[model samples]
Target: MTGFDTFLVADWSAAQGVRRAGKDAIWIALAQDGAVKPARHFSTRLDAEAWIAETIRAEIAAGRRVMAAFDFPFGYPTGVVEIICGAADPLALWDWLAARITDDARGRNNRFAVAEEINALFPGEGPFWGKHNRDAYPGIPYGGRSRTAEVSEKRACDISAKASSSVWQLAFPPTVGGQALMGMPMLSRLRRIQGCAVWPFEAWQEAQAVLTEIWPGLIEPAVRASDDLRDRAQVEGLARALSRLPLAELERMMDIDAPEEGWILGAGHGERLTDLARPNSLRPPPLRNDCFALPAGVDWTPVDTALALLRERLHPVTGTTKSGLFEAEGRILAEDVIARRANPPHPNTAVDGYGFAAASVGEGDAVLPLVQGRAAAGAPFEGPVPRGSALRVLTGADLPAGVDTVVLDEDCSVGDGRVAFRGGVKPGANTRKAGEDAGEGDRVLSAGRKLTAPDLALAAAVGHGTLPIREKLRVAVLSTGDELTEPGDVPGAGGIFDANRPMLLSTLARWGHVPVDLGRIPDDRSAVAAAFDRAGRDADVLLTSGGASAGDEDHVSALLREAGAMQEWRIALKPGRPLALGLWNDIPVFGLPGNPVAAFVCTLIFARPALTVLAGGNWAEPQGFEIPAAFEKRKKPGRREYLRARMRDGCAEVFPSEGSGRVSSLSWGEGLVEIEDGERHIRPGDPVRFIPYGSFGL
Candidate 1:
């Protein structure tokens, strides 16, 4: 009875700019049982919405069960509920944001400006950071700390393969913020459809068209990440993947307890998320107006959304100082690299050769007479080239006035400085002109640019003796677990060394942040709180591993809830399941999973981007490479998954197991073989997606 007769996938777009077919426009795909279809494109998002509406109605009328999965977030991070809707209900927040953001049926919209407007409320550069036509909002940094630090990112059932995007990220391609902003309105309409139900928020019904969110990367992570591939490939591929799903598996993914946070259809939490009998109460989820996120067990925030949300409260520090050119390299510039002088300083020869006026040689002449004094580099000829004469000019030498060209030595033979050359020489050949590379007073490099070798060279060439730069950030790490011991010390029976603390410290150091170790906790509540206080006071960011989840042994989390607010975000990520973001005495704390693999995944997927932003670096996703599979796998739908894998002989070979606790699997792989949430039956030779660990700097 839970099986669906039809499966449809929508590859959504939130472009507020020009739409082109087979590219920026929306595409949809459909499948049923053994029948699957290629993707169909629409000229406008509205056209696609209209088509979906028609399909839903037709399916309902025909007495067939239809399940539709769209590629936009159905929910945002926690606390955003209050900021967005002024309500605790996640669906209400969706409706609110959907109403404020406008997308015409024709695809023309103000999505970019709207992103700027949303960012205005956040504390830093943005939760949203890319755009094509729009300039960034003034005073808003190009890179800064996450605004939505209130929510724990990894708690949402998101796999690390495809991170979520904020609702405010309306400008960039691949970022689904704009799509969610614009798409939600249409989704609200569908919710009101005669026979429709949005999962988790709306209880499922057999006759209703069950609508859910889908991660396009779930089935084709690397393919979707490929620049050469069109998004329709994702739609068509995922639609086919869904159609191939076993009926039992399909039902399991659909049945989850996601009321405040909408669930992804193929998150693969199916068996665990299956409908469970529980007591119903009038009590509702808590809403936090404080700095920390409010806890809600079931519907956790997606990682991308949480990151954007986290960035909302934090801002890039405005600590700037002047540094000499030698010291400026590898630093973030605080002021524009203004040019004091033009490059080259004066017109000079572009190559080593003889310089002469083209008119000096007759149209029929093959050779020219000699001239006085050779114009070698650094030895300019103050006088003009005499009529009917040539001068030997070395490369980088100033071209004599009235000389319009330079003939290479290889092209001519000089006897006593007199040049004999080819039949005809080109005008202005191999010459350098005054201010050719840059003009005086030109802003060679803009402010906020991280000075690299090329950037330093550019600034130095323009006579910049010193540059202004921002200070580096200070980061601290804490590990909390009863079973953890220091690696240097022998562990007691049944205890393991605390791997996450040192690992986080090392990761922070690699990213140019000052790392301060807060040491480890032995699952004691009071000790955990005191350690948190110390970390907050000593570092710009306080990070903790283990005790992030609400287990009996999660003493740190229990203390966090008592001292400050703690939100357990159930990110749809494999290897990691929960992320905690909290504030103790106004200091932001990042809580990660206890498992070394999960902690590392969360740090890569959430913390890395956040740290970069805090250090005035723009938010970016870790890109993946599309490769072939060397092994087969069978998995359920509901949670995104990551498998340690190595590229071998042109194929991606996955590790034998998918457990997060297996640190050896991580060490054994060069990268990860990603399996997007949902039922999947992968086989050898299939085009599988691989994300290299090196891409994340692991």
Candidate 2:
């Protein structure tokens, strides 16, 4: 996966004045390898543009991928592109603006004059609006849309992002019209460099430098909590957030193909971007253990005793590997995964309501003056609300400092900039506290547990990009008997295509192990011995089908016994009565029955859990539920039985045949019905334990 080694985010301004510092100033922040440097302030766009070009050049010289982001709209709405540059291409508009727009070193520009010139091309009023000195540009409307507007108020990306203001609204904190006028030329200038490419308009994956539009409001909670000015904090926070994301996520963010009306990065992933606002929390080392040697025994074992032995003897045999979250699904954790940051990252509102200090409200109905600005998702209120005043807050918006209580919008009556509400609401009601779900350093996932899709989401919410996973266990599988032939090959008379090797190999992969094919061997003792030797050298464990019983053609068992390393046990189980457990050249081997049905059942009931332990996980246990039986059976039992069964109409129905040669029964059934070891009679309504195949990690 390719990723950027350096990140830069700039908060642009359109003010025409001398060099200045503080709010509404040009601030550029740089981040690398999860660490953010102090933001550099610039009083003029010319100076900021020069510094950006120099930084990109230096980083590219050092062979680093660089992502340059700006906090402004990259293009206007749908039809505006065709009208401004007389073409549908967005880059053409950049060229158009670059040729007509002008700016200087002391923070001076002719953006208002350009807006006036563009407004003359439209009909009644503007597709452009809002200026500090609106009277000077009479052609541009002070507020409201044009009667004959060529474009919509907001672009598709802006609508999906729930941005507070349209690109045309320029008189407020969040507007970007004037900034776009001044910034487009800067983009056009930057793209002229040899290796710089504009995203969504040019190929960006292999470029040495990429430039894209960003919206810092997507992670306002992190910025609002900072002690620095809003402009500086937003730039630094966004740069750090982008630098920590994995390569796949960054690719997904820029997957949009908007060449005419360019898109904003992180537009639809608001909660995801917000959760990854901070980095460098912590991850403890992986747990290490190796205990996979079974005791030597040659006795008839009961089913319960065999299972107990496996649980007692098995432990992890694999090491750990670092994997990004995108590729970590179905893999077992090698240790506990800790949270990198608090969930929510800051206290936020759970409802669209009014927020104020709870102590200010008395027993009677309370009326409080409303604050000037409202807090919406991705756009938090700037300062703390007064003790006696209430601030309007939307769902998922961060609560301003000094406010701890909220009253739902429906519960309050509003008029004259004052909200009156019943006074019995509890403190912190309708508000979620910071770190309520999972705090920093909290264990989000445990060792030996297989990761699911929801687990990846939880880990990301706690600010993790990579995870520690156990290395996959390698299990070699082989078959014996000249009667079997590989699939996709010509077989001679009386020869059957091999089924057990393919079935077991597929099962091993689904259970998260690497399956190695050792091919098929004839019923010759020397050939079987050679295959076993090769398997021991190449795999952590070996699984062999057929030739376990003491018969004329049972060469696998004969070779193992001659080596003095085999333990042939007669387990009290139906269809899978004989199980050969032994070691060959120090590598464990499981010899399964030749019948397909028996091999599948034994692999699930015994080998699945054993393989899990050997793959750096804990003992695997399948969850079963008792369901009413739909068939009747009479049994005089000294052994446990697993019948191929499927669920229908809330009852367990077993297959008609119990023969080990009925291979199709494994596919006909959804799971197995376990019958206990006892003399018993079962009727149609009797409860039987049914375990689904999925419960065995199939």
Candidate 3:
């Protein structure tokens, strides 16, 4: 028998809360009849599972056999299944997880709690490890074990796939424990769909829709293309490759399946699969480890120098995905969108009046006979408007073959079977030439551009229905301080409501980033450490507001220096002098000042443009204009300063207070008036740089 007619590959995620198309989120790519379709994204497992089931049924209804593959492992190590379910069956283990895992529609789930419960069933820390909150899950361990007398860390297939992380390792890169825990339930639901059969466990030829586990990493080298999202490329590449494999080869790869612990398809046949697939060269490069590293002995950096370093070091850390034109607004382009056809598509009239060869009009006022029929918009006159004869045309009408010039209706007199116009109505006047706006194959939108509504309109006019755009960067926001409490919660005396996290999160959303809330972390060493680990796993970057300074309670910077790569930047800027740049487990972290106003300014001045570059766009320079200052003050030479200000009658007005501690100043002003470095006595009429809030994409 031949192989299945369709292949569907799903990259699963364990992230909580609904998410957009982003790195580490679920992506489903399909290949039908040897053609790979654009991958689809799902924010929650319920949605992904529902879509997968419907797609399988539709394909089967169409009489095409389907093969569905999931990236997570189908089962745990051999003995663990028997210990958890009292049976040597992977399907039984799926049922156990499905029954206990409380995954809501929003993707909030009790997977960690379930892991802890499962650990209680076994002695000396059960198989699952690496919970985000170690204190909350005492039953679960924080690290993996080599082996136990009864259980093994890895199954036999992991060695075949050369996978680095075991099923027991969670919370770290390359780990499969969380994926399997969160995914198995969805897999179980998919297996119950009509005409579905589990691979290796069921007869393949007899099943109309086969569901199996896949390891996209097995062919990672072949799909590691530049400028594309890794998850997107992997699914697209693997689906296309696997759908081409012969049934005999597929069966041979499945020859040594552990029925209790399901085998990854093509686990032992990596060379064969890799050879059949061509590498995809369309993905963004993974973020480099040294992107944030600075040369030794560099300290007390200037604002301009710090920004320059960020621009030089940063690259697009997000992946690319195809979005329909309407959905592409605010998204950065992944690749240049070329025009499929020219704008106007044909020589057309720009005004409603006379159209005739410019040669017929002699450089003087003239009159000409009219053509038999008028061309208005979509309608065109039949024959060429014989050289000397004028054709009456309306706006947007295609010009007759012999016509080259037109006169505006208001500038001409048309009646009595003739049209007359004033002199100096130059050749090609009021006419739109073919391809005037954009020609076929021309780059209408360049890569790294953030798409706007006008851009969408232009793309649609040029025949582009969809655009390739970078996935939104997931930025985790955290706040640290013992004296702060959530806004809605009551604080007895010293506690104040946390503002930085919410403000940062809102700004991130406005700037087209997916904001991940890591919640508040008190000034505790271990708590900060746990939050950092979680941030690494959950977000592309972490933005922390407090505990960035070197005070004893400044655990954020201290831990980063101790455990990960860090660069303490004593930036030469007033109100926001202390800044922390670091990498926590390879994820970039930006630590801003504790003062609300300073954090707001730093995020705009530093993080704003840096994030734009990281999100696959050009280095963003917020638009600023020079306007006369309404207030005067003396300046210092050592650092640049920004005063919360607003425009009043076309002049800049500084706020009453310049203190970074004045949280009210942020809301009191419309924008910031920038004071350049160097001592200066500002006058009321002095030209000052004014940056509106809108310029920062706020």
| Best prediction by TM-score | 3
Clash number by candidate, in order: 47, 0, 6
| Model 3 poorest 10 in a row by lDDT | 272-281
Candidate 2 has an lDDT of: 0.83
Best first by TM-score, ranked: 3, 2, 1
* lDDT measured at residue 625 in model 2 versus the true structure, 0 to 100: 100
Candidate 1 lDDT for residue 506: 78
Residues 1-698, candidate 3, lDDT per residue (tens digit)? 33578999999988889988888889999988767898899989888888998999999899888999999888877788778889888888888999988888999989888987888778665777785666777777766653233577777888878887778766877658889999888877778887888887766666889988889877765566325788888888788768656443465666664787788888866644653454434646656666666668877787888899899998888766656566678889989889999997999998778799998778788899988889988787888889899888889999889999988888878789988887887888889989999999999899989888999999999999878777667788989999989989998588999989889988998998768778788999999998887676557788998999899999989988896577788888987967888888777889999889999999999999888888888888989999999998999797999999999999999998898889999998999998888898899999999999999988
* Root-mean-square deviation (CA) per prediction: 25.0, 15.3, 19.1
Each model's TM-score, in the order given?
0.55, 0.58, 0.62
Per-residue lDDT tens digits for candidate 2, residues 112-210, read 788878877776676878866656777777666444566688888888888877787666545588889899999998998888999888988899899
Where's the lowest-lDDT run of ten residues in candidate 2? 284-293
Q: What does candidate 1 score in Cα RMSD to the true structure?
A: 25.0
In angstroms, the error of model 3 at 48 is 17
